[model samples]
Target: MPLSSRLPILLACVVALGGCAGHPKGVMSPVAVSNKTGGSKVDMLVVTSRVPSDDPATLFTGERSPHPYLTDISVSIPSDSKRKAGTVQWPKKLPPNPDTDFAVTRVQQLKSVDQGRTWFRAHVVGGHALVFVHGFNNRYEDSVFRFAQIIHDSGAKVTPILFTWPSRASLFDYNYDKESTNYSRVAFEQTLRTLANDPNVKDITVMAHSMGTWLAMESLRQMAIRDGRVAPKIDNVILASPDIDVDVFARQWTEMGEKRPKFTIFVSQDDRALAASRFISGDVQRLGAINPADEPYRSKLEQAGITVIDLTKVKGGDSLNHGKFAESPQIVQLIGQRLVTGQTLTDSNVSLGQGVTAVIAGGV
Candidate 1:
């Protein structure tokens, strides 16, 4: 089924599984799980919330406390090699607080650890650590699991860490979602700083999607300004389907200066959601939705030593524009593989061919 049509059904399934059990008022709702396999079980966390839909600015101005909704979750993955179904259940609601904590209820050891087709304890043995920032309307578990799948499928050896900010998860509250993105910036930076201080983590790569890109850039900017240098621990930054204003992003990039990472951006001219973003921001020129065929922003980003991947022609899902990274297996593989190896893709890896392409002329 088309992803657009499939979204409602998937959401209904998530709700019907009773994952919202014991949800606190004015906080995030819980996720429901339906396990087809009655095998070993483990606990996870879920959060849900509600907000006004029409305006994007409302998200930031709301008086809502910045407290994360916590829950105890149980997940059951099939034990049989042939079975591939499982369910996740959220059992209790947690109090609102600035500090969040998780106590693993139970864990089931996987029989085999092939790609992310199965679940296992996430451990970073030797590779770099990757921190993923999800776009608007994403729950903690959804982001983590999706990224885990990508990381595993790409055969990346790095530990995957999800930096989940609070999301209302309602289509109606576009403004509220934007506000939450802004509110989470400080917290996101704290997490990065903490990770940078860790001895076990050798290098870090940040993958921020949609509005999450704003948070990532802001956090990085803060880190750089504070230390007077880009945190050497961080290696790369990936922005996929960023929803920021092109002018705003340009200013941000300019401020970043030499502190920037080996940056990569995935843009598509066909992204419809970005069209809406352009209307909302009233900007005729935008970077996130640039047409690779025209290569308008490619030159600028390349000059900044940022790699641009134009996936406008890559075909796969109905939500093609919205979920190119997660839905497209090839894109996922490329990101996972490169991130795992800590390889910085340059013009050579992209094969610009003969004359100077916009990406090459721009500087990348």
Candidate 2:
């Protein structure tokens, strides 16, 4: 065949290969990933209730009901270079080198957290562990990268574990995400129980974002209902940009009762994301966007024994203002050093560290 005759066939083949490359690569569990920010390799353990997708080549892509399966993975994230909070960046494509783009290096399978605990022991602080539950619109990779960013930014030695639910990973999937979160309640409880029951884990901190807060609270509430008390190992709870309804949150707290972990709720009146969520859900006030300076609202939360950090006044990073607790460098410092370490935070502490004048209601 002449050069002209072969050119069209070669071009067609190249185009087909490129199309296949863009499709889902499928799930690779127990994968090892390198971290560019800290220049280290970290392990990410996943516990999910999502069913296996037909694209079994990829991990956890099915939209079916909660059949609940657990996977442990490791991956490297893009480096911050700036070493500041609220500044995490992800690459558009997976590359050969983590320095170039985020990609998984290795993967291995594990039966349960027993194997994970071995890895967890190395990161524990004073025998403490940190459990993070991610919110709506998150895929497995998105959850892993965000968790790694938070852990790296916090500079805390505590072991970090992520509980990821089946999020449709779409803005239009709000209702689907809500149902998926609710469905994963039992599985989330199991993840907590695994940590709580482990003798190696003496103290634990639970953090949840957006819709994950609802799942975390409901899971704990269910455990409390069954055991008649919250786990003593759970020493602290952090709810960042929680998308729960104010009234529903009050009821959830009531169900869980007292003797719970020290509760910290990060709220911002200017959170446009939560504002949109409110508009979607019948115009009810979502918890994350609540103004702490309000008359009865502040009093109600304080009475419930919850600590509310109002971020309406603080500036820098996250224009939407829905993720300041983890995204804001100043607040991330507060969370990494004080919150996870079990240090009591006050107005002076905020001023001394972040140098921002914040409106903090309900605290010691």
Candidate 3:
């Protein structure tokens, strides 16, 4: 109601994002990889703009870095055949077991862009790649572990590239996190440009979650403005639980011009994290919290040929209902098989045929 009333509620939502400090720091420290290890592994090329941490274990901090930092990290997943999909099983103890925990199996620092290009040549099969952007309140290791889980569970057959930005990982630093995205826009744009320019990269899927969507959209908008269009290689843009202001997103979409990438958004009205974001931004509706089936959104989104999947009734492991995209097995795999892997999809009644039947609105 009043500003005083809203502040406490916003702070409470911020508190739901706690527990980052509870985990051990520097979980990125590489562990010995053994041929005898039973669990699976996911290796990612991480490009970050966060200042390198003084502690080697942590690798990067929330503060900004002058240059883009690159690393290749391998993560070991739990061996259980019945392991829950869309969840990162963080190690309860250090030097985690490959059979029972998510652990770092290998870590390497790429010396230069040439070295990264070499990676692209070696890894990108048939020119398919996935670029992931982590959201606010995430540390370096948090994004790593989560992206690893996604790649593992989604089973997307593509070169995995993670673009992690500087985030204090403190919910109280929400405004600072938002600004960090703005500051790192150029670096992120550079990342997209590099991938687009690579001959080995024929197709790219850019996926952004939470406030990272703001950064991703801005980068795309800038790219479209600079290059006369969003890169043709960047075919699909997935925004999940995006924390973008609706009006701002409309401007971004307009700036991207007519020949833009196909957009798919995952939204839920029950997203408490976005509710806090709404209050902090003067109650403007966030794009990820809209109902695509109703009102001005329905006609506008349909006219733009944008797809929106509403996950309001989709039960998620997240208490806040803010992470259904990453927390639900059906939805994540649907992303991998159909959208990220470059499948030809159409809007139909059986939207994303992964046993997830709650396709309330538009789809691709």
Q: Estimate each model's TM-score.
A: 0.67, 0.83, 0.94
**Model 3 segments beyond 4 Å from truth?**
1-5, 16-22, 344-364
In the range 97-162, model 3's lDDT, one tens digit per residue, is 677678887888898998999988977767888999999889999999999888888889889999
Task: Assess each prediction's global lDDT (C-alpha) against the native.
Answer: 0.56, 0.71, 0.85
Residue 107, candidate 2: Cα error in Å is: 2.5
TM-score, cand. 1? 0.67
- Residue 16's lDDT within candidate 2 is 45
On residues 1-364, what C-alpha lDDT tens digit does candidate 2 reach at each position? Answer: 5645644554454334323223233333333443324555556666667666544235666264444555555666555662344654454433334663445656544565667676566556677788899987777667776787787777766777788888887665678899988888888887888889988888889999999999999999998898888899989999998999988988888898676888888888887768767766667899898777686886886676677787776673644666677777667777788888777666665652443444454543
Query: Best to worst by TM-score, what's the order?
Result: 3, 2, 1
